[model samples]
Target chain A: MNTKTFETENQLIRAAQAGDQQALRELVEQYSDTVYKFAFKVCRSEDDAEDTLQDAFLNILKALKTFNHRSNFSTWVYRIVSNSCLMKWRKEKRERWESFERLDNPEERIQDSYTHWPDSPAEALLSNELQEKMDEAILDLPPIYRLAFVMKDLEGLKMEQVAQALEISLPAAKARLRRARLFLRDRLEPYVQS
Target chain B: MADELKERILNICSELGEDIDSADCKKLRQHVASCQDSSAFVDSVKKTISLYKAYGPNIDHDTSSRLLGKLGLD
Candidate 1:
């Protein structure tokens, strides 16, 4: 969410919690993109993302009455979507056990890596091919790392928020993000240099 | 010493856009300026993140309305 929308989000949350249906509709409109994008990135499938998105908002409406306004509503919604994404992954058997291994061993760096920064990466990334490669690289990441990276980097969540969403320690979230960056750097090095 | 420097550089890269003006970051910036490898590492990581940031995706209108309809908000 952008700064402007985030500022209003709290008000909407309070209003929605107070049984304002219009506020609830506004909240959904504001967050649907963020939630859907997160789901698509994590689930890597449009159908799965759509399912998760629908379930997330429905669950949000059901749970809104119990929301105590302790945490940011966005963070609470992220927790819901993250849970939904994980459940979908588990049912699909997409969450690999090795993701935990990679998360545990931060010392193991990407091997045989060579990278030369492109002079115009912003321009280079505009190309459809490179964008597709970047998307694929993200999808190929281990689920743990992917979630951390997507939440922190793509979704623009703070480290603490990411940790909260993923139900991990702050340090664990940081480690996963670092490893995810290194892993993606290795995968996209060829394109960067070319 | 080299491994430690590399680790510090990578850590700085990970912390990009957060606190790039800290004493340690200033020192790392100087080190990067003097060292080609460190500079390359920092630049590449920044580029990688920029690419990721540039690829924003939006929810389709149909999907949004369909979801809203299901929730009876439409």
Candidate 2:
């Protein structure tokens, strides 16, 4: 949390922008945590999150020369990370969802695996019944709604940032959030009273 | 009665806002109140939060070290 660390980071970015190899590597080390977490929030698995992190950093490295200084580094990096995650999700969908129906309610096709991360044991141990029920609730949500829930509710991203990352209009993002909340309320009715 | 409770829940959500542990939710303690339904509510809410805490990539501390080793920072 030192000011010095941040200052050093800013300087390193400037150097990395100019193609300094070491600085670029340092930048990767510094922000990869954010990239991985973002991916995991969406992907909900360790292996996928790890793949997304490495791919994001690699993409950033490839695209560094075109890096614009006008944007916040965090935001720009998020764009790259978000794109990577989306692509990965799309790939997974293609593999598993070729014959799947796209429901307007968005809850019809919720992925059961969204609730449980295969690699996380603690998530498994947190109250076995609760975890299972939670997973079912998440899966009950539609993809857009689930993504909105994960992005805004869980990842703590603002509406605007989420819209940018998802490449959607602000209103669309808000609508999705509403749907996500409504859907969760429906499924949670049996479980929560107060 | 059910509708009233639902309204209260939604109002609590609106007043407290969304993050499972928002300042308002924490301050009011309404969402996680000690009640039959409240327990289940908290349990489910926590499942979401715990998904991030446990499965989120930052939980992978070994990543930084392993990444450092790969990049020769180690």
Top candidate by lDDT: 1
- Writing each residue's lDDT as its tens digit, candidate 2 over B1-74 gives 35355445534654455554667866656534666665454455554444434554364668766655654545
Residue by residue across A2-58, what tens digits does model 1's lDDT show? 433336666778888887778778888988998888887676567767899998998
A77-176 per-residue lDDT for model 2 (tens digits): 7777777766776766644433223322434454436434454666556566655556565545545556767778776777677677667887677666
For model 2, what is the alpha-carbon lDDT of residue A49? 66
lDDT of each: 0.71, 0.61
Per-model interface RMSD values are: 4.9, 5.1
Return the lDDT, model 1, position B47: 71
DockQ of 1: 0.40
Whole-model lDDT, candidate 2? 0.61
- Clashing pairs in model 2, backbone N/Cα/C closer than 3 A: A106-A142, A193-B37
- Top-TM-score candidate index: 1
